[model samples]
Target: MSDWEPKIVSFLCNWCSYGAADLAGVGRMQYPSNIRVIRIPCTGRMDPKFALTALREGADAVWVSG
Candidate 1:
């Protein structure tokens, strides 16, 4: 079988969580490479439809950080 990596869709708040993610990148933190981040102005502005769409589009998981 072919190697498979989980596809994760992450919704991050522009204020804090996004910055944390940036730090993780700058620090060279080890994490699955399958995660894809989407920055939003705020968690309050997040819509359920976005997660649904990500799932429908074949994302193995969806995460939100704020």
Candidate 2:
């Protein structure tokens, strides 16, 4: 539908996972542009509802990193 990029939502832990992703970027790690990452204080804090809401809102994929 209209040159849409795949909507990928990633929930990452603030201390570890988020830092890793940032490192990946800084290292020039090429990845799909479809990803949209959201950093949380911790992966333990994520609720099921948050993932459901992402899909409900039209995300093609949702990933959680810890």
Candidate 3:
């Protein structure tokens, strides 16, 4: 059987969370490829419709980073 990777959408703040994610990549941290990153100015900038759209688009998980 083929291994299935779970899909995860991560919304990170441009100031800190995005930096952390970049560090994770630069540090060669091990993680599933299914995770997708979206950088935003801030967590409060997120609109409910965006999350709804993500869910409608078939994302297995949505992560909001502050």
lDDT of 3 by residue, 1-66 (tens): 277677888889998899988899999999778879999999989988888888889998888888
Model 3 residue 60 distance off true place after TM-score fit, in angstroms: 1.0
In candidate 3, how many Å is residue 12 off?
Answer: 0.8
- The C-alpha stretches of model 2 lying farther than 4 A from their native spots are 1-4
The regions of model 1 sitting more than 4 angstroms off are: none
Rank ordering of all candidates by lDDT, starting from the highest: 2, 1, 3
Instruction: Give the 10-residue window scoring lowest on summed lDDT in candidate 2.
Output: 1-10
Predicted structure 1: lDDT = 0.92
Query: How much lDDT does each candidate structure score?
Result: 0.92, 0.93, 0.87
TM-score of each candidate? 0.88, 0.87, 0.83
Quality of model 2 by C-alpha lDDT: 0.93
lDDT (Cα, tens digit) per residue for candidate 2, span 1-66: 788788899999999999998999899999888889999999999999999999999999899989
Best by lDDT: 2
- Please name the candidate that would achieve the greatest TM-score relative to the true structure: 1
